[model samples]
Target: MYTYSDFDRAFINARNAQFRAQVERRIDGSLTEDEFRPLRLMNGLYLQLHAYMLRVAIPYGTLSSDQMRGLAFIAEKFDKGYGHFTTRQNIQYNWPKLKDVPDILDELAKVQLHAIQTSGNTIRNVTADHFAGASADELEDPRPYAELIRQWSTDHPEFQFLGRKFKIAVSGSPTDRAVTKAHDIGLRMVKNDAGDVGFEVIVGGGLGRTPMEGKVIREFLPKGDLLPYLESVVAVYNLLGRRDNKYKARIKITVHENGLDKYRELVEAEFPHRRAAFNGIDQELLDQIRPQFKSPYFTTAPKAEFEKAYAKDPVFRSFVDTNTATHRNDDYAIVTISIKKHGATPGDATAEQMRVMADLAEEFGHNELRISHEQNVVLPHVHKAHLPAIFARLQQADLATANVGLASDIIACPGMDYCALATARSIPVAQELAERFDALKLEHEVGELKIKISGCINACGHHHVGHIGILGLDRAGVENYQVTLGGDGSENFAIGERAGPGFSYAEIVPAIERVIKAYLEEREDDAETFIETYRRVGMAPFKAALYPDADKGRKHAA
Candidate 1:
């Protein structure tokens, strides 16, 4: 994790002080609601349907145990007992008294955390692979680069007021766990012909009312040129991006309206000026940041206890099999604590749960914790010998669900339960789905499935890339859900195709059940995942399953 320097701390303190005065002005009636809207938004405060929501940035999703404790404190003291972890690797408190927000910001600043750049049209919190440094397959740690981007983008004069919000994701691993394809700018670390590591710069990919996968503007950009190139790209977008319409103002739309070739040409034209402006200052700063992310001292202790538990304890074995991931160090494993337990809110962790996670991270994870884009907490470096003890602690805290990539482990936003923009309730739908799947006992049999739910067309839940995407909408004063099949958020990213008509809220769960059953029937074998089956047979079979009576109705009409 990149520790905030003296200068960084000073900047945050000043910003917090400034926002504190602004909050007072609004409360005292000196500033009207209309006047306070922008001011509040700049500080990551939003006036939701019921109450104020504060989004705190977890830069590159990294957190220390102390920081986690701070979040727990905030959840307990200011808002409700729980905090909602978002798909962007950030946390949002859905219920905060407007008067208490300034206090919350002050509390966050104590732990070196802040809500800056979490909202507004400015570049949002820079996200990266959750298993950045610990992943065995990654060529390098992406967090260092992510930190550099964070330092550069925070309150950058030019980008602070873009036409629309922009998101950037960095992935050092070839596997693309970061979902780089769906970001405003996706930086995938790659090797050039000369065998030097660089980035495959992808631009204009986003999911909302208009979802589109990013296109590769640069096949390979040198490592040193990252800042300048990114500057050029954003600069180009700032100049050409639409402003008249808020809906079509994102860089994705700008790139879509203007051809990729033309965009590339403009970016290329701007690159030289950006390059000259940097003058190697970025590279010098990167060198300083690199050492902070060096691998933690790993233990080479024997895994006899872990082996014994894996063999003797079926429950522990199941948890291990379901939740643990391979780490770069052979002696260690990356443990993803599933915040999404069956029948619960998808990405919510109670204050107590947060504290437990913090304690576990301090004890077994070298005091380093991560918030994954999938809305889960990650212990990126847990020794294999400590797995049993860690699992025991998690079990005590009700965090041991043993479902990581399984069907019951769904990614859902706070939906209508909290979000003002939500048309229908995403929490209830997600909860019902998880409970339904758990009762059927088919999660293990079903295997890896990405089921994402969004409350509206905003795509905050990232439904477009889910293996089975459920998008909730308002239809004739009733809640309805539209299902999209074959959407994926990996390196081979694809937008899911909608399957026929929407399902009423009452019928949506059963409708999803039908789709899964169809997959089981059509799959070549058990090893073939839902995505594989969908790819092999296409949506015709799933569509048939979803709307069984449609064919008969068509025939009768004919």
Candidate 2:
């Protein structure tokens, strides 16, 4: 994990002090709610439906044990007893009191964390693959570049306020776990024909009312040119993107209005200026950032104990099969601890659980913890020999659910529960779905399904790319849930297709069950996942299942 330098600490303290005064003025009636909105938003504070929410950025989803402990302390002392880990790999304190926010910021500053650029129209937290340095499949760790981008973008004078909020994600692996296609700027590291690794830069991808996969603006961008090229892209968008209408303000919409060729031309034209302005400072910063992300000292260990535990305990076996991913070191395994136990909120972690995770990371995970975009905590460098002990510790903490890629492991946003903009509830729907699937005991059978839920069309929950996407809306004063099928968020990214009419809240679970049952019956074999079946058979079967009486009504009318 990257530690803050003296310069970084000084900057954060100064920012915190400024915000503290701003918060005080708001409380003292010098700044009214309307007057203080933008100021608070700039610091990642939001006035939610009921109370204030503070979103703390976790850059590239990396954290140390001390940082994790700090978050746990914040959850315990300041806000409610829990914090929600978001799809962007940030943590949100939903019930934070406005008066206590400055104190919380101070506390976060002590741990070298902040809420800077977590909101507003400027670039948000620069995210990367959660398994960046640990994953065996990646070309190189993406976090150094991510950190470089973060340092460059934080409070950048030109980009402090854009037409709309922008998100950027980087993934070094061939497999795209970072949802690169659904970001404003998505960088996937790829090897050129010359066998040199660079970036496949995808721009204009976004999900909301209007969802579109990013277009490949550059097939291979030289690693050295990354910062300037990114600046050029953002500069072009800032100048040309719509400011008249907030709906069409995003870069994605800008790209849509203007052809990709024209946008690319503009970006290319701006690139030389940006390149000259940078003058190699970005590369120097990157060189400094690289050492901070070097691989931890790995130990050669016998896997006999891990094998014994797997063989002897079915529960442990299930956990190992589901929760662990292959690490670069053969002796190490990347362990994803499921915070989504049956009936729990998808991403809410209690203070105690946070502490437990921190302890585990400190003890067994090389003092590093990663927050996955899927809203789970990962011990990215856990040795296989420690599996049994780690599993035992997790079991004690009630954090040992073995459903990493299963149906129950859902991704849901804090919808109507906390968000003022939400039209309906997301957490309840997610809870119901997880509980229902767990009770049925069919998740393992269902296998590798992603069910994302959002309260509205903003797609904060990434419903557009879920295998079974659920969008909850208020339909003429009633809660109606819409479903989309065959969506994928991987390297072969595609937006899901809608499956006809929305279902009532009461009708949703059964409707989803029908879809699952239909899949089980129609799939060619057990090995064929829901997505594969959907792709092969199309929406006809799932549609038939969701709206069983549609054909009956049609026939009767005829």
Candidate 3:
């Protein structure tokens, strides 16, 4: 974990003070809802369906044990007893009072966390691979670069108000765990033939009503020139991106309308000028920032104990099998604490659970925690020898659910339950589906399936990339959910295909089960995962299972 510098501390304190005054003005009736909207949004406060939701940024998804403890305190003190972790690697409090938000921001500032760019049409939180520092396949940790970008983009004069919210993701590993293709800007760390580090820059990618896979703007940009190149890309989009219509305001629309070649030409033309302006500042800053992220000292611990624990304890064995990832260090493992427990609210972590995680991170891990895009908490650098003890602690906290990358590990947004923009419920749907799968014990058989649910077309849940995507919609005063299949959130990312017509709230869970059952029956073997089966067999069988009558009618019509 990178400690916040004095400069960082001062900046957050100042911002919190400013927001505090704004909150006072709003309460005092000097500011109407229209006048207060931007101010509140800038502070990461949203007036959602039932109450105000406060989204706190966990920069690059990194958190210290102290920070985690602070969040637990906030969750306990204000709003509900639990918090929802979002796909953007941020956390949301569902029932924050309007007046208490500034106070909350003040408290967050104490822990070097704030919610400034968590919302609004400005550049949002810069996300990176959750396992950046720990992943075995990583060329370099992406968090330093992400932190550099975060500093540059925060309250940036040029980019404070974009046409729409801009999102950027970076991945240090060959495997794209960060879902780079679905971001406004995606940077993948790559090494050249000469073994020099650089970024593979991709632009114009996004999801919403119009989902687009980002196109490679630059195949190889030297690590030193990252900021300048990124500056050029965002500058080009800022100038050329649509302002006339909000729907057509995204950079993806700019790329789509102008064509990739022309867009590339414009960006390339702007690059030299932008590069000169930055004048090695990015490299200089990165040189300074790199030291802050020095690898934690580790003892040459034996892995025999870990193997013994795995052999002896079934729960520990399952935890190691499902939750742990290979670390760059031979004796260490990256353990993900699944927040998506069966029948619980997706991404909701209780205050006590957060404290337990903090304690675990401090004791067994390297005092480091990461929040994943899949809504899981990660202890990034845990010694393999500590696996049993850590698993025991997590199990007691109800955090040891061995369903990482499985069907039960659902990604869901705060739909009508919390989000004012949502027309239907998302959390309940995700919860029910998880419970259904657990009851049937079908998750293990399903094998590495992503089931993302969004309240609406905004795609906050990243439903577009799920193996079995569910979109909740409001139709005629009823909550209806539409299913999509064949989607993947991986290195080989593909948007899901719609299975059939929407299902009613009462029918959606059964419909999902039917689709899964169809996949099981139609699959070549149990070895084939849901995605593999969907890819091989396509959506026809799943579609038929969900809407047999509709398929038959279409056949009759044909």
Query: How well does model 3 score by local distance difference test?
Result: 0.89
On a 0 to 1 TM-score scale, where does candidate 2 land against the true structure? 0.99
lDDT of candidate 1 at residue 369, scale 0 to 100: 96
Error of 1 at 322 (Å): 1.0
Looking at candidate 3, what is the lDDT of residue 536? 85
How far off is residue 556 in model 2, in Å? 3.5
Q: How far does residue 223 in candidate 2 sit from its true spot (Å)? A: 0.6
lDDT tens per residue, model 3, 1-558: 567788889899998888888889989999999999998898888887778889999999999999999999999999678888999999999898888988898888888899989989889999999999889999999999999999999999999888998999999999999999899999999988999888999998988889888899888998888888888889889999999999999999999999999999998899999889988877888888999898999867778878988888887887788998999988888999998889988889999999999999999887899999999999999988898888888778788899999988999998988787898999888889889988998887778888999999999999999998999888999988988887876889899888767999999999889888998899898788888888888877888899878878989999
Preferred candidate (lDDT higher): 2 or 3: 2
Residue lDDT tens for model 1, 300-405: 8989999999999999999999998999888999999999899989999999999999999999999999999999999999999999999999999999998899
Candidate 2 per-residue lDDT over residues 1-558, each given as its tens digit: 688999999999999999899999999999999999999999999888999999999999999999999999999999779999999999999998889999999999999999999999999999989999999999999999999999999999999989999999999999998999999999999999999999999999999999999999999999999999999999999999999999999999999999999999999999999999999999998888899988999988888999998999999999999999999998889999999999999999999999999999999999999999999999999999999999999999999999999998999999998899998899999999999999999999988898999999999999999999999999999999999998899998999999999999998989999999999999999899999999999999899999979978988999
As for lDDT, the candidate ahead, 1 or 3, is 1
TM-score of each: 0.99, 0.99, 0.97
| Candidate 1: residue 20 lDDT (0-100) | 94
Weakest 10 consecutive residues, lDDT, candidate 2?
Answer: 546-555
